[model samples]
Target: MLRTDYKPQSIRQSGQLLQRHSSRGFRWAFTGTIIGILLVILSFNSGSLADSHASQLSTEKNKISAEPAQQQLSADKAKASIKKLPRMNIELPPDTDGRLSQDQTDIADEYENAFPRRALPLSIETSLYDESADDENPNTLTAVTVQAGDSLARIFQKQSIPARDLQNIMSLGKPVKALTKMMPGTVIEFVRDRQNTLIQIRYPLDETDTLIIDKKASGYHSKIDQVKVETELVSVNGVINDSLFLSGKAAGLSDNLIMQLAGIFGWDIDFVLDIRKGDRFTVVYEKRYAAGEFLGNGAIVAAEFVNQGKSFRAVQFVDDKGNRNYFTPEGYSMRKAFLRAPLNFLYVSSGFKRKRFHPILKRVKAHRGIDYRAPKGTPVYAAGDGKVIRSGYNKYNGNYVFIKHGEKYVTKYLHFSRRKVRTGQRVKQGQTIGYVGMTGLAEAPHLHYEFLVNGVHRNPRTVKLPQARPIDKKHRTLFTASTRSLIARLDLEDRIYLAQLDRINRQQAALSNSEISPKSAPQ
Candidate 1:
């Protein structure tokens, strides 16, 4: 089937269709090219627009900042001009409107009402005002507490007082000597004039006495002024269960008061060895006061101590010679010639035994003295007022001291670490003669004490001591009359104490019975 005649016509139609497809492709390509060019132009225009907008904003911001900068410059210039103006202390007169005058002209008239004026420094104002006031009124008093290491001269210099004034005060001699020895916490007052000259000085010596030194026409004069003090009797009592110190403290007795009590009855009873469990004591002492304020304790008026079922009472009395002493109701003195023990001891380590084993010697020997166990360096006192006959150290006795009282009595002390007395030195009763130690022939720290009469050693514990001089016969009636009320008061206080103690004991027993009855009940 060769069809040559229809081939040309069909070919012409195909070629025309091809030419039309080519023209459509070219149109599509041209349209795409135009859209791409337009998109690029739009992007460039948007970028330029954003840049212009940002430049406008920045220009506005710069202009805004320039306004405040110019304002600040002008304000600074105004301040500089104000500072350059002259200052004067000229005061302004008040107007017809009843306004107050001001010392400064730069401030407005209404400135005082609107704002407060700045105050000057405290130190400057104080100096100026105080100077003026002192000139007007010359008298002024300055008080100072005496600090440690502060001398009178230093204190005076600190207060601007003249040295000549101190010399004048010191010229008064013994009356002003206390000022030189001023203790800490003492308050001293100085009176001065406008010229910084000292006029007077006041120092309180105690609660009731004050030493006042004043500048008079005759140099300086000093006088002690005493305040009237009222005496009050305070009674206190306590029973011992542990020790005198602890029981006295529990009864509200101060240490000084307890020691005073011990000293009053120390002649008859040894506090360390003679104290019992049920011993009781009552004391009436004087408390001094001024204007209803307590000053301090004065003296013990009367006291009673009951030991081991025996009661001892003493009352303080002043003799005609102005010597104060404690005496019994029978007009007898409470003091004795010799003390039972020469020193305060812990316990009796070794008694006076004719046949006893010695710790160091390891054999039975005659121990003529009592060994009193005590701490090292414990004070050893003289048993009676006597002269030291021998104070020396030996191989067996160690450091020893011998005191001879009159012609018949002699006391010996051995085993001392330190000797306080010398040979031929007179020592008072209760005076410290030596300190205890563990010397030669001693196993531990102890005091070996021996009492001799006519060269014969006697047991110090059982030896009878001599009584002191009694009250004078002329004052016997007065002593009895003055002491009777005190003794009766002591009896009354004892009865009251016994009653209270019985009541407490009954209450304790009842409580114990109640507690035990519940446990012992039958179930």
Candidate 2:
């Protein structure tokens, strides 16, 4: 502690102290600079890593966005290929499970066995004839040809058969009345065994076929094989102006086809009254054939009718339950409870009225009947099923006829051109009774029609008709089954047609939007 103010005396000592302090400060500064440099590098590296991660996320988002587009493009290409492919035409087998195999074999065998393999030898022919003559049994084959107006009963009578056997055979089902209705020009063959009993009875049902009945211990058994034919689609179009029959003829359609069309729309519209001019219609239907020969038109598969600017379309279809009913897009039945007119007639001239001027009497009188206007000689039809009660001429009414329909219904027709039916004659619904003429005190050529319920006159135009009975409970099951199949068939046809239309529309849209040249389109 002596001489406390004394500073360092040696320069070297002062220099050493200064150098040590500088070194320590320099070390601390160096450490701080190194830490700052490391922090800067770490910040740059972290920023670079974040940028890479962002870029990878952006690339993943882009791929995800393009995946749906790529899939859609692939699907479009597949659809194009499918559209370009040829349509497949599959022909189903004639028989589903070889039902005709046995029949076919039997037919072939019968043809092969038509003639005996060996004829009787001349040496044995004399012995056979002598043995046959000595024996009580007759060995002969009789062939009978059916002529016009000849029936099975007449043929049997000619053959001298026992009446008791005929009666027994007829009692099985239908009597000779049913069998006698057979067409003429058919041949029948009978073969007798050694016991003189009928061994076989064969007859030609038609020109190309024959049916055989064989005697058995259980009675008689017969085999009948019907020939089925394939049919093709036929399309027809027409415009109805006057009558359905005339329109069908003009359109090159058959009467049966016209009737079927009327039946299809009968439930919704009355063909007798609702038909108007310019009503157009188109039908795609089927025709039946047998052995490459035309039979007739079968049914209407699809149809379109444009009536008074309104269009109605229907497709034949069978459903799962087999209930056949024409429906709208919403599945509403087209059929109502009853038909508008039982007899689809022409036009109505005079309607029902309480008081009307009599044409002949020239005075106001009660008009109880509906008058239909038609050309003279136009046939009049029966409104319903009934029996003819009266057919005669009168002073006020020219040539008239009265028909008793059911227990509670009666109808009358007056001023006819002529009477074709007689009293006590059974008439069916829509049966033509006579022509239209001014035979009575009518102003013009017209038909006077009347409907009576329990002998009281009713307004024919406004009368409320009774509904047809529904299917019987016993037949409901069968009806439902059959209807479902038919409905399904109709539905399939409709779907196919709609799909075809959609494809056409899509093709048209593509043609409008695409850059493909018109020459590339299918011709």
Candidate 3:
């Protein structure tokens, strides 16, 4: 500055230096301003982020501190509730292997020891008798009387013997056949071993007796011996009210026995039509027993049926020829040539008459046959076995059938709605001939029945009937034995009924005495 020299080259150089310095300073200033603005914006944003982070950390600390207190309160409540409950005791059942407990094992042992045991006792007398006897053992024999209806198998079962023993004993054909047919009231002896096993079974064959061995393996055998027994006679009485079947049951009679009684008196009495109220029957027969046990009832050896004040008695007798026949006391055959009626309950709507007023014609006419009143379409049967002679319709008889029985018997059925048989046809007894109807000159449904002997008309209701064939001579002896046993059973039944009646009477008498005593007491 002191030397102020003014030169063109120096001036130009100075201005250039001033311009370069100013340019450099302006560039530095602009760069510094931009960096400061960036720093300020970054500082403001970083401060906001730090504040938010601190607030989040404080909330997390508060949550961590409060969680433990809530959990402790929940745990305390749970413990208090747990303390308020009651305790329990439980019992379990014992195991199946019997190792559960001492008490259980002891109870099981006691149950096993409680059952009873039995031992077989040998008889000393049997041994003594066997040693003293020669080839035969002498011992007391017990006999069992065979009751009526007792079968071999049944008796063995009742005595508690194994049925296999019966089969072994029956292997001997002759002994089994003889014993199987034994009649009720017969005596059978059974010999048993010490073990209660049957040793021998003995029964009668005919006049000769037989025995059977019980043990097949030992080849044991039976001995035959003869013994006699006695039986008693008994009577049974019955009265009829509703039907013959019921009356027989009321009197302790079986259906088969009642039917036999009905058949015995079927000839003289028409059970279908002639049976009346208060008809009483009494049968006297034998009662048979083996060892005081009841057997089955036998035949009606003698019977009486009192009907309508008339008494009919029949006695079964075996003649010299060994033929059995039912006859009256005076030896009259209890049989007739024709039965009174085929049906048991038919009614006589019209009777046999010479002159009778006809219902259809309204005039007196000859009515030769008996008209039986029955339901419409009631079956009309052939009274006996015969051949049909005529079966057709006629003017007076709408439908008719005429049957000829042998040479002396002829029967006619008229006024039928329809015919069942044809002419020249064979018919059996009780075969349906036609049906009842109001046909021809009849006023109602009925069967006009007629019986003729050699073409002469007779009364059908009072006609005699034929008898059934008697038992053969060959079976007579067996029949008598069997019948006697059955009769004995019937007798026992009668005694039982009498005993029941006595008991009833005693009860009634006691009741009557009690009632009278109460009335006579001073009140």
Best candidate (score: TM-score): 1
Q: Write the per-residue lDDT of candidate 2 for residues 430-478, one digit (tens) a residue.
A: 6788888888687888888888888889987666666544444665455
List TM-scores for all candidates, in order. 0.64, 0.46, 0.41
Task: For model 2, give the 10-residue run with minimal summed lDDT.
Answer: 114-123
Q: Which runs in model 3 stand beyond 4 Å of their true positions?
A: 1-237, 242-265, 282-304, 308-337, 344-346, 466-469, 487-523
Score each candidate by Cα lDDT: 0.85, 0.70, 0.71
lDDT of 2 at 181: 64
Which candidate has the highest lDDT of all? 1
Summed over model 3, clashes come to: 16
Q: Per-prediction count of colliding residue pairs? A: 0, 17, 16
In TM-score terms, candidate 3 sits at: 0.41
Q: Which regions in candidate 2 have their CA more than 4 angstroms from the true location?
A: 1-148, 158-165, 175-177, 183-212, 222-224, 229-233, 267-273, 291-293, 312-339, 344-357, 373-447, 451-523
Could you tell me which 10 consecutive residues in candidate 3 have the lowest summed lDDT? Answer: 114-123
What is candidate 3's lDDT per residue for 224-283, written digit by digit as tens? Answer: 564343457667788779678888899888877887888688777867567798787887
lDDT of 1 by residue, 36-102 (tens): 9999999999888767656655664554456553243345655664474333344445663554345
